[model samples]
Target: MKFFIIILLFCLPTTLLAAEFKVSGYGSIVGGKVLSGQKDPAGEVEFQVDFYDYAYYDEDWAWDKESKVALQLVASINERLDATIQLVAKAADEWSPDIDWFYLTYKLNDASKIMAGRRMLPMYYFSEYMEVGFAYPWIRPPANLYWWEITQFNGLTYLYNFELGNWDFDFSAFFGKETQTKIKSHDFWRNRGGYYFPPEGVYISGTADVTWSDIMGVNLAAANDWLDIRASYFSTRYTTTSDIMFFDEIDTNGDGIADTVIERRTNPDGTPIRSGQWSLTDFDLSFYGLGGSMYFTYATVLFDYNYVTYDDGYGSRFPTFYISAVYNHDTWQPYVGISQAKLKITRDFDGFGTGEAEEHQIMTLGLRYNVMPGAALKFELNKFKDKGDRSPWYDFSYHNDATLFSVALDFIF
Candidate 1:
């Protein structure tokens, strides 16, 4: 995997292209800061919008949290086959580059095709182009609705496109899997919450890996001049593993006697000790989603909803949705949005594990000014509200509202 990804770094030259190859790129420079109310346990105000990346903001304005630049290349291998690759440099990673896509597509017919390789998971309406800030009116998508631990997968997809009457239709089925190491969600919830864990002799560590296998999904959609609609379903096997382990002692019998003791460590005062705990979420996961858009001469309205179910009662349901309306005025566009996610805990696992999330909502107000055909300037203000149990966004909880302001320049070349 290291060698394969390293090769992409060399293929990034786009200035000089062949007849069969074309290159294009896009970028977003976004800056944001917390306005009021959100403070950490140390009494310092801070902001963290994306749990998957763990990029953050403080009371002062900052830019590196969400800005990124990406390049894409498409090569025509033959009459029926084409190859593509995309790489991105994210500000949160100190401008380190990461590969977002590398795939090959084979045209089966004029209306059908098949693709194989790594690509973003189409779990939401904007999943395919979510990072292209120029494609959306806001600096970013609603964090509550777009949150997902796994965004990309190594997979194969069969796509068919056809027109029925005055409307065009698209249908696709995909199968793939992905394994992520040293994920952010693991450490984000590391030191939060308290539980009745094993004795203090054993060492506890945070989780490190998230594996999604046997991922299969189908998406169907139709669109006309004024309206478009979509629906999708997906299922996969989920597993999470710990990052570190320390074995202390083993009781050979039910009599609580340590037979083959690995180590004998106890409390500082020679009393019973207490330590942190760790666990994993291993289960079958299912997803259902619905989305639609309405376009008018002066305005556009979009809505998306998604529901996730963890089978075998490993956890409860996760339902998220977003609704936004944008009004267009020549080169100026203004928008407002509302989005939320509901995370529930079930007693099926004896109240042990959850999706490791909270129930929250965000209200958005933003504006976009098209500087030119391929460039835009955006400004947005978001109000974040935690509506339910604040299990752990930080090591502690902040029940009050936190307002954030952001601005961005979205461009393509």
Candidate 2:
């Protein structure tokens, strides 16, 4: 990887001389430890390192979970056209480089433009800069609100910028599609006698192909000397097809060959098991967000609220909100934030049996120190409380509360 980067750096000057090209990069080296938490009563506290899902945290000062590096190259093609390519290396994937954004921008007018190719989905105020730690006030964004299955879409976007009565509006309409594959382990079968079965856990791999049609969104914001306000609304029709494979190797019948097994869904009391996979074809999801910030000489206050709902009545209605304050003193900035989320699943569809609701709250305190011209150091402490039943996707045995401590060095060049 170092060699690859060196080669790119050496060739960048030549490219810049030939064409209007610019290169920039950002990276973060982060380490974190879980002070306390466990999923099961007898289970030991361990770090939850989920790279694909950014909500999880690292424990024991591990670097191969949250660290990442990104490089972006923008090339101007004539006066009205430009191309950008961004590559990212994440610790969760062993630092393997992946293309995050590769797009072409065509200027239609002074205030209107068109973009084509793979780009980030503008789901939140910080969506475009979510990977850049320096752009935010915390070690990371609030996980309760930022967690999503998709981050990027491959398609086209039309953006128009205009001023409306002393307020600036950035309106965008996008059409895109995305496909993702996720792999995880699950407890396939449990013994009635409370005995551990052979191969206690089975790996379940699934692929989700989603198509987004008629996706549209608008963002409006205005700022005065000390106040800023913004609101966004996005709606889309989502169609998805999924296939799952359960790697079950148990020879329950003592036969010479393994038997095909299907997943069983049970009620909260673990009775009346139903067989087969849960799948959804076409659905709709709408997102709404409102946020603002108040700035003073040395202190700032920020607050945001977001709500999401699915087309199917059985799907959960999720609402999240956060409030934070930061004080800036020279090169050091100290901040504290509180965030909460509520998940309420409407139990109307029989396809989704026995929906469970969950509630969570988190408090974070952190400090950021500008170490140098293009680098910053940060330390953060987070306390998480799970107030309700565990979400289906999360571990069933998670504790009620957990504490985490993290420190990171972020840089942009």
Strongest candidate by lDDT: 1
Q: Name the Cα RMSD for model 2.
A: 7.9
How would you encode candidate 2's per-residue C-alpha lDDT over 220-261 as one tens digit per residue? Answer: 767667878778887777665443333445567888566765
Q: Which lDDT value does model 2 have at 344?
A: 71
lDDT measured at residue 90 in model 2 versus the true structure, 0 to 100: 88
Q: List candidate 2 stretches off by more than 4 Å.
A: 1-18, 40-55, 164-166, 183-214, 237-277, 280-282, 313-315, 350-356, 389-400
Give all TM-scores, in the order shown. 0.82, 0.77
Give the residue spans of candidate 1 off by over 4 A: 1-19, 41-44, 194-207, 244-279, 312-314, 346-348, 351-357, 389-400
Q: Cα deviation of 401 in candidate 2 (Å)? A: 2.4
Reference-based lDDT, each prediction: 0.78, 0.70
For candidate 1, the clash count comes to 0
Query: Which residue pairs overlap in candidate 1's backbone?
Result: none
